[model samples]
Target: MIHPILDDNAADALVALLAVREAGGVPLVGDSRWSTQYWSAVSSHAKAECVGGDKAWASFSSGSSGAPRVILRSASSWQVSFAAVTDLLALTADDVVYVPAPLASSLTLFSVAHSRSVGASILLPSRPSSSAEHLTRATVVHTTPQSLRAIVEVIEGGAPHSMRVALVGGDHLDHALRRRCAALGIRVIGYYGAAELSFVAVDDDGLGLRPFPGVQTRIVGGELWARSAYLASGYLEDGGGPFRVDGEGWGTVGDRAENDASGRLMLRGRIDGAILTSSATVIPDEVEAALRSIDGIDDAAVFGLPNERTGALVAALVQFSPGSSRPSTARLREQAAARLPLTHIPRRWFWTEDMPRTSTGKAARSQIRLCALEKKARRLD
Candidate 1:
């Protein structure tokens, strides 16, 4: 039987997971807020796969690029990483970890499991209103960059509390965000990983992403492939999602990466997500990072728009920092030109007061592209 989890309590969910694991059954941990129809579809898909299989757990992907799908993995996959993280973070029974994200998120589920493994206490918000209260008591926090920003805003200038460390994932943690958290006495530990390949690299001191313990990485044609015990079995779907396992036991989720001069793995986004514009390939991640580095720019989402002349033209939707006056498009263009190549520079510019993001706090590239094509977003030029 599949254990469909709707409970938000971390302790209760831990107990249920332990029980389900002991019973040798698959547990489907999902968010209760998912639409009934969507939940039914995901559960039905998982149940079909769980019948007569070695799968130990089932969860949904973040669906940042597309619809969420059922992913299956052995219990040992997470169990091994739980021990790694517990040791890496030096978690103890006395520690209180706050996980504000829903149970459906693999990041939160992994945090809860890791906390339980180390005999640490976990604080999960019963409602949106309880997040701040939980943060006040937490010795550690596990959340996305977007959620962390909201948290920083909530507790700004307040007397420091018990929270000291934040384990951030699901999006890039910008320098400004990290500095803000540091001002609040909370150290951020940003990591790069996927639900399919657990814990590929970690950045503890903001140097860069080094390989996580027990994981070996290699860049194949600019695509990163990892070999580790933490890899998931496969997806429950027929095609098995984008996860691919080689004959040599290496698995990859099609993430693009390169080794810097320091040998640290630098992510360049996904292989399939690259935009083909004017016969030149452009990685939106590279452009977006450049835009974010500009003065007064808070965030950026780069995408491709269909163009009869260029086949596809690079476009960008940006958000400026709060209290900063909006600069002219020409000024913004000059700033981008200095930082990016001609092909990487955005041809079309748009602005958004509130940027659209996935549940995991990732830039919703597909959503933004759709909005721009539909003329729903405010065209800046």
Candidate 2:
């Protein structure tokens, strides 16, 4: 059974998932909002090449980059760690779970499965909330930092809320967002994971993230590798999208990470997102981190665009808070130079009130590049 995220209500999705599981049928979930261009890019891989057991459930994912893929996994893949995951959140039947993302997303789907295992009630995304009254009963929320930022921007009540914990992922979250969530009486738990490999690690420690109890991890040649019982079966209709399996049943999705002095995992961002400049290779996330650290900048995404002189020139799109004093492009360049390497500084800058985000609330870098090349948006310089 294939289910699109935008097709039906949360209740209907839940019922479909349960029905598939009970009937020993594979249930695949897909995002319905993909543009024609995105579909065209992956149509070559969408032929009748279905693999995996009838009992396995599949979900479409991009595996961090490039074209989308259908990932296959048996119920035990996630069920094996459900108890440990809930125990980490201290979730119980009394807790009301909330996931602001669509039901077909891996994070939201895993949250649904976990909540169902623990017998907790869930509030899926309804229309955008103008007030916090709809969230009065929510105790725990699973969302990305972008979606949470959108909620905080329009929400009205500053009164103390009932939310206790938040499972945040999908992108790199800065300390400012964490502070904002703290002010709202919610504790933020940042995690690093991929659809191919479920929950790799969580920021249970203040320094970074410690691996889960049953999870195993190692940093090999700067890429994070995992050996866990929750590993998904290989991608369908494709050789192996950005992942490799070893003889020991360990898997790696090629994400760059490192261990801090305290043995906690610290992500360095995607290995494929590095831009080859004329002078040096620059990782966009590194430049983006520096940009967001400056005051008045709420979000940032750095990319490389074609240049006549250099093979590629660094460009950036930044988001600023409404009514906040926008800094000049020269001022931003100076501040960025102090932190980032000279070659990493953005050569062209564009400003937008809102950053481009995908259905999963992740920064849409491909779209940002298109917008930058078009030169249609407001340029800070």
Candidate 3:
């Protein structure tokens, strides 16, 4: 039986405690927002509950649409993730690792664990908003594209610090952002994985991720399928049962990918709800990456909409950078043509203050697609 500790005041701490519970251990969670009551509650519970082995489970929220789903993974998976990270970062015992994301996030959890695994010191700022302070002390940092951008802002504003590496994932890493980080002497490594499947591909320590240890990837039907011991058991409540593993122990997470002739894995997008354009198929991520490279654009989301002539027309919902206005549709078209094929150029551009993101901060592709469809419908009406 699972008895999760609830701390309404601290969501990350609460989730971390629950994960500790789920992995066959007990957690003494308390309200960090309040002092005396919180510590007392935690102490009482810890004294009463049985102390178990180090192996434990933790839950994290994940989804592209609908309510977030809770994913459970073992502490061992975190160890594996950390091992890969330490290998990729070339972390040393004396290194200081910084985590800006919440501890409940798999990214942050594993990053911290990875640092600990290598005997490296961890420097977590008490506040999430203190990017500059955290960046100043750490040798390596883990961040999403958005967070990395914030770090870039700090550095550009004359923050004095140098990082050995900045690992960017949780979203597509644009070449523009990569170039900026590169100029700062911070090598940006893009990793691709989900809570359901942890650390599928990590940039191969300057060589590019050539399949990490204990993981295998294959391109089946233009979709990327993976088999790894590190894959989660399955989702809670959904009872989807265990991931389908082959006799050899390979499992898939339903991501679409392409392999270069040299066998490097390039992720396309998800298999479900992929865009089928008039001239050719459009992978939203591929197009989104292209769109993000255009000057004056901060970020973009690419998806498809119904069209009488083209089955589904490609469209982009974009947020231009500050002090920048929407580009002329013609110029936008030219920019896309420079990197993408004619079929992949978005037929229409919709400007928004910001692209909507999921609870986990991933670009909500499903929501953006729905918004595009609704606007298209309004036009028809």
Score every model by TM-score. Answer: 0.91, 0.89, 0.78
Candidate 3: global Cα-lDDT?
0.67
Best candidate (score: lDDT): 1
Cα lDDT listed for each candidate: 0.82, 0.75, 0.67
Which 10-residue window in model 2 sums to the lowest lDDT?
Answer: 1-10
Clash counts for the predictions, in order: 0, 0, 7
Clashes of 3: 7
Better of 1 and 2 by TM-score: 1
Overall local distance difference test of candidate 1: 0.82
Residue lDDT tens for model 2, 1-381? 332223246666667776867776666654546665654444334334455463366676643345557777778999998988888789999999888876667787788788989999988754323247546778888888887776555443454357788888888766777877777767888887788888888885445788876889998899889999888887766464776889998888878888888888888777877888897988888888888888888889888899877889999999987689888988999999988888999998999888877656677787788777887767885
User: Deviation in angstroms for 341 in model 1?
Assistant: 1.1
1-381: candidate 1 lDDT, tens digit per residue: 677765556557667876886898877876766688977777676665544466677777777677777677877898988767876667889999887877777777777677877889887776433355676798988888878887888788464467888889987788888999898888888889888998999989888899988899999999999999999988777774778999998999888999999999899998777889887999988999999999998889988899988889999999988889888889998999999999898989999888887556788888888889899999885
lDDT of 3 by residue, 1-381 (tens): 224444443445645664655566634333233357644654554345443354355444445544344455556766665666677788899788776665546666566557766889876554454466677788888778887887888888889775879877787766667888888889888888777787788773444456766778887788676877687655444444323556776676667788777777877777664788666877788888888888888888877778888899888888789888666778888888999988888888777776676533577777777877776411210
Which scores better on lDDT, 2 or 3? 2
The superposed Cα distance between candidate 3 and the true structure at residue 125, in angstroms, equals 4.9
Q: Which candidate gets the maximum TM-score versus the true structure? A: 1
Q: Against the true structure, what is every candidate's RMSD?
A: 2.5, 2.8, 6.4
TM-score of decoy 1: 0.91
Superposed by TM-score, candidate 3 places the C-alpha of residue 176 at a distance from the truth, in angstroms, of 4.3
Q: What are the runs in model 2 whose C-alpha is more than 4 Å off?
A: 1-8, 35-49, 62-64, 127-131, 151-156, 374-377
